[model samples]
Target: MRLSRYFLPVLKETPAEAQIVSHRYMLRAGMIKQASAGIYSWLPLGFKVLRKLENIVHEEQVRAGHIPMLMPTLQSADLWRESGRYDGYGEEMLRMQDRHGRDMLFSPTAEEMFTDVFRSHVKSYKDLPLTLYQIQWKFRDEIRPRFGVMRGREFLMKDGYNFDQSKEDALHAYNRHLVSYLRTYERMGLQAIPMRADSGPIGGDYTHEFLVLAETGESEVFYDSEITDLKFGDREIDFDSVEQCQAVLEEFTSRYARTDETHDEAVFNALPEERRRVARGIEVGQIFYFGTQYSEALGATVQTPDGTSVPVHMGSHGIGVSRLLGAIIEASHDDKGIIWPEGVTPFHCGIVNLKQGDEAADGACEALYGSLTALGLEPLYDDRNERAGGKFATMDLIGLPWRITVGPRGLKNGVVELTCRRTGESEELPPEQAVAKVAEIYAGI
Candidate 1:
């Protein structure tokens, strides 16, 4: 991608309305545009990163054996009515009457819809442990939607529903999702702690919110420091062995962690001072074991081995896909712009043609761009006639993990400079060696 051909409408000054660093930087970098008060149109660059995040979520969900199929954004009110939540869901629910004067809604969540689907197809215990998910847009009608995409009324989310025949089996499904969530955040370069959470509108007794700690976060959370350092790589996933999956979850859950709603003063007091951490955190993902909540209401029953029909025990897991873009920026970024994690970065490397019109600079940049593309690295070539400082600023603002400067001096001398955006370390290497070095560095990141 060339900067001259890109649709990045970067601003010279911060927008006055952006309250947080992530929100402000997102606007200044031209990543998104506000389509309305609580909605946004994701610009090209923003959409690229959003797709990467969604794919990572998809991969992790698939690894946990959850199949994907999309559901509609609008749903019939009769589905909600079966759950007795048509009236109970309150104003956040975007309820309306259709042309036929029948009630409908822009779905805030998909429990009732999934329930209806489950009951329609699977009739026996053999289809008991099924997990289905989708990555789609949802509308909530937030009264005071602010903070850019972080709390937008319309956003992208990955929500999964699990159906099982018994509470114990449903819990096994929940623990698989728990492990999957840990791996999902880990892949995105985030340390998300699973804390007990209030069920809220998604009614359930057992709920866990995967939160990433950031200074600008909305929720107050306390956790043992070790929880942040816990590595998912330490254990292997045995999805078929329910007990083993439960053990892995118990190992991580044993470390003290709780959101404000479930925080225990005694537990906090007992922790050694150095081991404790209290901070604000963003809720990036949430999982709940709502035993028969939607299934019972919607009559999603499966026949048991003894030929008795019972409502399938159920759970739902959600990842705030668009909100994570903001959360990633909040956790990262310095005085410059976003410092994107390599896994979710829109481009792998950015090639700055510091002297765009100069033949040597242009030639070297085009060659390097071709080389990067051949190596499966997406490199943005700043072939626009711009000052070195402006090109550098744009590259930093877009926040590719690696940067290569093809300046007049370097091109003339047969050496190009490769810089690590995160570390600000630069090394001058012959043009022939730059591609291999970048491939090696990015492979490590």
Candidate 2:
């Protein structure tokens, strides 16, 4: 992508409404524009990153044996009524009437709709272990929606539902989701701790919210500091093996961790003084083992071996797909701008033509860009006729993981400057070596 042709309308000054670093940077970077209070239109760069996050969620969910499907943004109010939650869900749910005067809602969640789908076609225990998910836009009318995408009224999310014939099987599905979520967040360069959390309106006795600790987070959390030391890394696991999934669940959750809503002071106090810590957390995902709550309400039952109809054990898991961008920025950015992790960066690296019209510099940048792109990598080339400082500032603001600076001075010495965004470190190497180094850095991710 060439900067001269790109539609990045980066701002020179931060908007007064942006109260946090992510919000300010997102606005200044022109990734999103406010459409209304608490609503936004994702610009090209923002949409690219959003799609990247969505793809990662899909890969991890499918890797864990879950099927992908799409559901409508608007749903009949009858489903919520049947589940006895239409009136109970409160104002956050956008309830309205269609042209026919039928009650409708912009779905805040799809629990009731998914239950209706299950009861309509799935009738036997043979299909009991099925897990289905969708990445879709959801709306919850927040009275005071702030913090950009972090607490927006409309956002993208990946929500999955699991149906099982027995309680034990349902619990295994829950464990599988936990393992998958750990991988998903890790791939996005985040360490989201799974903390015991209150289920709230979702209504579940067992639930865990994956939170990334940031000072700007909304949730107050108490946890064992040692939990931060754990990493999913490259370990292999059989998602279908119940014991293997259960073992991971225990390994990650054995420590003391809970949000303030479910915090047990006694249990927290029992931890070694050095290990106990309190902080704020931004919730990125959650898993719930709600058993028969929705199934019983919606008559989503299956016939067992005994020829008896029974409500299926069920659970819902979710990842805040769009909000993750904010969380990542909050956790990873420095004072300059967002430092996108290689796994989710919009472009693999950037090409800066320090002397835009100079023949040697232009040729070097063009060659480097071609080399990176031919290797199946994306490079953002700042080919605009602009000052060196302005081009460098834009590259830093957009925060590509790596940048290659081509100039007549460097080319005369048979070298180009390759810089790391996160470390603010640079190395002078031949043009091919700069391209090779960037490719090598991103190969594993």
Candidate 3:
């Protein structure tokens, strides 16, 4: 993509309403624009990153044996009524009536709708261990929606529901989700700690919220500092093996961690003083093992081997797909701008033509751009006829992982400047070597 042809309307000044770093940067970078008080229109760059995050979630979910499907943004109020939550869900759910006077809603969550789907077609224990998910837009009318996408009125989310024959199977599904979520966040260059959290409206005794610790986070959290040291790394796990999944769940959750809603001072005090820590956290995902809460209410029962019927054990897992953009920026950005991780960056690297019209410089940048693109990588070339300072500033503001600076001076010496956006470090290398290095850096990711 060439900067001259792109539609990035970056701002020279931050919007006064953007209170946090992510929100401010997002506005200044022209990643999103406010459509309403708490709603936004994702610009091209923001949409690209959002899609990248969505794809990662899909890949991890599929790797864990979950099926993907689509669900509507609007749903009938009848399903919520059957689950006895039509009135109980409160104002956050956007309830209304259609032309025929049937009560409908812009779904804040899909527990009731998914249960309705389960009961409609699934009727036997043989097909009990099914997990289905969708990446869709959800609306929750926040009373005071702020913080850009972090607490928006409408957001994108990946919510999955698991149906099982027994409590044990349902719990295993919960663990599988935990493992997959860990991978998903890590791939996006975030360490989202799985903390014991209160399942407010979802109604579950067993739940964990994955949070990325940031000073601007909404949730106050207490934890043992050791929990921050855990990482899933590249270890292999059989998602179908209960023991394997259970082991990972224990490994990651054994430490003391809880959100403010579920915090116990006594339990926290038991930890070593050195390990005790308190901080703020941005919630990026959650998993709930609600058992028969939805199934029983909706009559989503399956016939057992002996011909008896029982409500299927069930759970719902979710990742805040759009909010993750804010969380990643909050956790990864520096004073200058967002430092996108290679795995989720809109472009793999950037090409800066320091002397845009200079023949040698222009030729070098064009060659580098072609080389990177041919290697299955995306490069954003700043080919605009602008000053070197302005071009460099734009590259830094957009925060591509790597940048290749081509200039007549560097080309005369048979080298180009390859710089790391995160480290502020640069290396002088031949044009081909710069491209090769960028490719090598993202190969593993």
Clashing pairs in 2: none
> In candidate 2, what are the lDDT values of residues 1-445, reduced to their tens digit?
8889999999989999999989999998889999999999999999999999999999999999999999999999999999999999999999989999999999899998888888999999987699999999999999999999999999999999999999999999999999999999999999999999999899887899999999999999999999999999999889999999999999999999999999999999999999999999999999999999999989999999999999999999999999999999999888888899999999999999988889998888889889999999999999999999989888888899999998998899999999999999999999988888888988898
All candidates' lDDT scores?
A: 0.90, 0.94, 0.94
Q: List the residue pairs that clash in candidate 3.
A: none
Superposed model 1: Cα runs more than 4 Å off:
234-236
Ranking by lDDT: 2, 3, 1
User: What is the TM-score of candidate 1?
Assistant: 0.98
Q: What's the lDDT for residue 404 in model 3?
A: 91
Query: Which of the predicted structures, 1 or 3, would earn the higher lDDT when compared with the native?
Result: 3
Off by over 4 Å in 3: none
Error of 2 at 301 (Å): 0.6
Model 3, 377: alpha-carbon shift in Å? Answer: 0.5
Lowest lDDT block of 10, candidate 3? 354-363
Better of 1 and 3 by TM-score: 3
Model 3: how far residue 324 lies from native, Å:
0.1
Clashing pairs in 1: none
Please estimate how well model 3 matches the true structure, expressed as its whole-model Cα lDDT. Answer: 0.94
